[model samples]
Target: MQVHEIQVRSILTRTGGFLREGYSHTLNPYRGCAYGGALCGLPCYAQHSVWITSGRAWGSFLDVKVNAAEVYRSQVNRERRWAATRGGLRIYMSSVTDPYVPQERQYGITRSLLEVMLDEPPERLVLQTHTPYPLWDLERLRALLPLVPDLSVNISIETDRDNLGPGFPPHATPVAERITALESLRKAGIPCVAVVAPMLPIEDPREFARRLGAACDRVVLDHFLLGDGSPGGLRTRRTGFPSKLEEAGWQQWTSLEQFEKVCDIFSEVLGADRVQKSRHGFNTPGPGRCSETTTR
Candidate 1:
């Protein structure tokens, strides 16, 4: 068997205030990610993660954070005392590494953390993953449903194409497959938020939001091509998906205000009933305040 490895500083990072509220602490099962995505934070993975940004991230390498879950469990347990006395505890899963990548099929650290949350009961456990395949650990989600009721899922995807999958490393499930998995989670009564971030300029963004909203309880959109040209996010999907954004040359919007103008346009085109449009991005077309309940 081939051995893959990487080195890193700390596993998780607490960045972005207010938005990063509650789920500041994070955990990654693997040191590097398998479904190497461009936006991923793993600086070691060459496909996406941090490698492509500046070649600082090594390519297609694996650094199995051996004591990943155990480490988190110990630390969280320690913090529980203070958390209980002070206010609440919220831990974001897989900030640097995906908590449910293929290797998880064997290690099961994410599952273990879920179990811990069930036993200890954190005020919130925000689970985020790019993979659409829903690994339903029902016993856990159900157990903490009441206490950690703030559990939010951010299933990230760029395009809903089966072939336009990520251009990263060895990941089997395609975009369509992930969409199904996420839908399954929703059917099982889990609150799931689909994040179409790094929104590549492809596949009629409006239509994409409509279709995704149909499947998920909520939708969140973010721009991807903020002037970073790299060759990383091709493992599970494709890269050129962003070219469509570059080619179309959207309507007149040059200054920073142009983005808000685009969001207004998106709200108009996608429809507030079918696609909720906030200054943030697209969301489940609903009457409720969207971003507050959804984003982590």
Candidate 2:
């Protein structure tokens, strides 16, 4: 993989589209995620974005936003002044990229950004990723909690199977490790959730929900057809994910029927109040506020 240290003019971006309902702003510390080559690569909506993709392979390159923390500091200062007329900033960190990728250990850009947030904290910060690296900054995250108590870290676990999928990337963290990370984070008093986004085929829906309920505070279920960053999950369909599922003897996973079935089981096991659906739950509301509960 090629690494490029690129400087960005801005860190916080006004969010729209699927993220508009829950988050006010989005911050991505890096461009092109290291885990992009996994099964997610097949249906990754971000890859369809011309700006970040730049016609390059998804995992072939990583652009470290070297000045992300510095830029965020200035942005937060400005946002604070602007927020008086509006409301507290609900920022989703790393909407398009994973903040705690392997590069983070060396550069600490995500941690640096968190340090800046500690100084001028937002009302709510949702940190999302699919790896165990968030444990690396547990202390930093714990410190920020007093300032932004509503902060949440969502660990994306697409399926319960250890194989992940038929053609998942070898470098991606194992399914069991992610579940263990969620348990650790929950035990550490960090508000966390399990995101079954683009929900893949699971061996046992009841077992998955039971495990997630034990690990995190709540669960959010989604499927490729519902939230694949396209009008009709066209990007995912074009990747042949449906055909792949059929060939793998998991054809039911290609349809929303199975997704809803799994969601129903999760609701039954975890309770309806504890199970959120689609992007609405993934982008939870700020502190002292109630988000409109939604399902799909």
Which has the greatest lDDT?
A: 2
Q: Quantify how close model 2 is to the true structure by its C-alpha RMSD in Å.
A: 4.0
TM-score of 2: 0.92
Candidate 2 residue-wise lDDT, 61-172, digit = tens: 8999999988988788677666545456878887888888889999999999888888988887889898878999999988988898578888888888876445555536
lDDT of 1 by residue, 64-174 (tens): 665544555566666666556544566666555566677667666677667766666666666778776445575577566676746666677655544333443332356
TM-score of each: 0.67, 0.92
Write down the lDDT that model 2 would get: 0.81
Residue 204 error for model 2, in Å? 0.8
Model 1 spans > 4 angstroms off? 1-19, 37-59, 81-87, 163-172, 225-296
